[model samples]
Target: MIVVALRARSSWHKPAWWATAFGAIAVATYGILWATPVVLDGMLGGRNLLTLVRDAAAVAAVWFFHNAVAAQQRKPEKKLPAWGLGLAVLSFTVPFLLISRPGPTSSAFVLDRLDQFPVWLFSSIYIFIVGALAARAIALLSSEKTVMTRFYVLGLSLMLVGSIIELMYLAATHFGPTNPDFRESLYYVAERPFFGGIFITVLGFLWVYAVRVFWKHLARWTLRIDARHEGGEYLARSLATSSENGWSDRQLAVNSAVNIRDRLKIGTQALSRREHALFSGVEHLLSNHLERTPR
Candidate 1:
């Protein structure tokens, strides 16, 4: 979390920080709803309000995560329409208004008495959110070579799996009564996997933050360049490779010279030393190139 805050100084990490913040808020809201004992007309108002807030915040978290990662892509990323966002928020009300009573109900009643429409609506929104997160994570995993990007992918993947489990369990509670044995077993085992997923997600975020904060400094200190006697092109290529592989500094110094040596191993091929020096002085080409890289 501290790392996220620190990284927020850069434009690239701002959205990521916001995503985390919103996620935290959603979690807190859920905790409040579960623990509080306030009674509001014994029905739809308080519980529904809390649920809506949680859902809205969750949606914002996913949207921000997608936005941050997508900004790094070369091509524009797919976006949810504004109306689509509104619809997602609206779905939270369906369960409160139709499927669920203001107070708690028995598992049997929830399954047999309530309609499945609201349950499916709730599940679909969660699936869509997690699906979007998974897709973005996959894209980043495939394209970005950085180790930290993998951690980001891992975190999103964990959340996706966890969400699916929770959704399935919820569905089962509603429908599992059709088979009494299945319902009982599912009730016992359903929540365990969900927490495991949450644990992994937290760990993954820690790994991602570590890379974001320390990887650059570590690379800068550990990298050993042997281009001391090499030609300008050789040095440039080496630095370019390092930068592409996330082994170079965000800000680098580049220098070229007038009387630079342009000899090959054979000490042959003469070229304009000034031009070579100019190119050499330019910072690692990869640094320049990365301006366009979604990383």
Candidate 2:
């Protein structure tokens, strides 16, 4: 229980994972905020509100990748994680029936044109949209991929680009007949760009966020490597200094031996000179004694 709770808290710190989680949540939460514009009488504009939610969701999802992706692999596999992926895929299919298909045949209804689809169809569409986005939230936050984690950063980056393009198209088209030049426009084009772009460009934030998370992981490993290498080098230098000292000592001993040898030679020469002088004095005294005895 402690580990689970700790993991949950760490999840938000991951910028990429957070964005992704938020994006998924926004997709689901659209139901509650979708009609906010009608009751409040512009208390909160529809487009801006939806854009904010969507962008917020995207940011959350990005953070999820950062916090959980690396750690997810270590957890035990449960049946619930598989169910999540299925739900996410199902969500995508519902939009096909509710929103018009991209090519041509898919049925799509404008939000303003409520008469086009029955109430039941709208409800079904909402549920599916929520499921689809929620699935992404669950999949990214809960699952752990080993090889995929090793390589998927680039893939996720590409996926973000595709999502942004799709979101841009949706935002551009999901408009009412309100002209900005007239008083009918709830918000200016500039406002929509920031709001809508939140969903699309949240990916850019995710990219930087991904880099930051990975860098934190990379930094610790690098510091250890540096410390080990530095220590080894220092030890080697000490050994080299010791070797140089040994050479200096050897040179001093050789110089002392040469000085001792020179002193010994000078002492021997002085002793020989003293002996020669004593021998000459004794020979002169012996000759005088022999001459006096013969007389």
Tens digits of lDDT, candidate 2, 182-285? 32242233234334434443454455456555544433332232233346564345335535774332232232223322333454212235433432332233
Best model per lDDT: 1
Task: State how far residue 284 of model 1 sits from its true place (Å).
Answer: 20
Report the C-alpha displacement of residue 94, candidate 2, in angstroms: 3.9
Clashes of each: 6, 36
Off by over 4 Å in 1: 1-13, 30-45, 79-83, 104-117, 163-172, 176-195, 206-249, 252-295
Candidate 2 global Cα RMSD = 31.1
All-Cα superposition RMSD per candidate: 11.2, 31.1
**How do the residues 153-199 of candidate 1 rate in per-residue lDDT, one tens digit apiece?**
66666666666765676665665554656655664464454445445
